[model samples]
Target: MTAPAEPPRFVVMGPSGAGKSVVGAALAERLAERFPGLRFVDADDLHPASNVEKMRAGIALDDHDRMPWLALVGGELAAGADGRVVACSALKRSYRDAIRAACPDAVFVELVVPAGELGDRVVRRPGHFMPASLVASQLGALEPLDGDERGIRIENTGPVDGVVTRVIAALDAGW
Candidate 1:
């Protein structure tokens, strides 16, 4: 008989300030409790120091600046022995494609939030390299998941627990 299918890797994706890191961590925690072999990572930690410095100065990253970082993120997910949930902006379709190229089974969880709320969230967040001014650029760069992509899009405006619950439900439903 065939071996059981491997658990899916999760990419918690969105524009900046959509709570990818928090939600991804929560989702990974719950999934690990059930799956027993799951890990969570924030993609920002994979960024190069130059990229961090650029964002800290309110500079938006171009594809040239992001490609290498995306490769590292994808490599980390692909190399893991257990399932992984990663928080990444993945702002463009091309960026997602790059990740998929390395980890073909990567499933995205696109977090949606209003631009105004995103701006406010970024402004209130301390110590993050990304500035509130870059929210617009991130929003502009965002490409919503395509109909054919393996993922779900959920609104993240409500309570964090509620959002995590919905995401877990969707993953269970194989959406």
Candidate 2:
């Protein structure tokens, strides 16, 4: 008899205001219907207190401050036996590399939003540690997925449901 297909591991990645959390959560919920035990993890919750404090204080994090946290996120993704979806501001190629180091099979879904709109969304968001001021820094640091990466990018305008539908389609297409 044939073995069942392995479950997918996904990182919903982008800059700070690119709707990673919302999109990742929704995607996990939808996928869980088909892949039982799939879990959604918001990488923001994985941040060390110092990192959170740095963001809360409007200070952009440097590589020294971020590497450990990225390692933790990677470990979490790698530890998922069934399937996992994580929302993370994996802005730099090096950061994504860090995650891939731990979970080489991980796929990515990057949500793209205009800089102006991203700024607006972050400013209006409440209680989030990352301030709107950091949006520019994130955009400046962002590296879109390389051609060889296993992933897809979708414009994240209009309703969220539409964006989710696009993600599902891309996954169906074997992205």
Candidate 3:
């Protein structure tokens, strides 16, 4: 008998207000249909209380503040038995590297959106600790996936289903 294909690991990444959580959840659901053990994890839930408070106060977290949290997030991804779809800002290259260190086969999917739209979306999102004001900080910190990165960049200006479709297609194409 043939061996079962390995479960896919994905990181749905983007700046604040780029719909990482929403898209990641949807992607996880779709993936679960094809890969029974796939699940979704929100990186925000892994943040230290202090980090949450800092972002809630509209303060941008420095690398020092993020390293520990990133480590925890990476550990979760690495520990997943089947497959995991995680949503995280992962704004800098080093941060992505941290995640890659944990799950080397993890594929990244970057959601690209215009700044104005991102700002609007952030302000409209309810009960989220990340303030709209911090959107600019996230944008400033964002480092687009490099040439060597195993990932695909999708524009999120369209409907959620469309974006999800594109992501799945890209993944199937070995992006």
Candidate 4:
């Protein structure tokens, strides 16, 4: 019989409103049966209050504002190296590099959706500090997963369960 695949260290990454939280949660639930210690961390929880306030005020955060938050998220991922599913914006290549520095084997799952969809999703999301007005800025900062990156880009135009299934299949295939 084939050996079971190793539990994945997944970072559900994308610009705002790409369904990172929903998909990551679903992925974690699906993987929990096999990976007992798996946990999900919402990177937004690591953001400083000031950053949250800024975003709530419709101000886009700069790289400097994000470094500390990224470091914290990286630390969590590294600490949970055995099995973790984290939802994070991870917009810039440099930010992703920071995450990789902490957990070298991390597999990023980048969620891609059209701008209009992204905007609508962001606007409809309740209680999120990130305002729809900043969607463009987040998109502008986004750096797609590169050839050398250990990652996959999934279009999130459909149901959350469908996206989660694709992620699981990709992980099983060692993508």
- Per-model lDDT: 0.90, 0.89, 0.89, 0.87
Clash pairs for candidate 4 = none
TM-score-better candidate, 3 vs 4:
3
Model 3: weakest 10-residue lDDT segment is 1-10
lDDT assessment of candidate 2 = 0.89
**What are the runs in model 1 whose C-alpha is more than 4 Å off?**
1-4
lDDT of 1 by residue, 15-70 (tens): 99999999999988988876678899999999999999999999999999999999
Model 4, span 1-175: residue lDDT tens: 1124655678999999999999999888878877777899899999999999999999999988988888888888878535789999998899999988888778899999998899999989998889999999999899999989988998887888898888777766877
lDDT-wise, the better of 3 and 4 is 3
Candidate 2 vs candidate 3, lDDT winner: 2
Candidate 2 to truth, TM: 0.96
lDDT for position 79 in model 1: 73
Using lDDT, rank the candidates from best to worst.
Answer: 1, 2, 3, 4
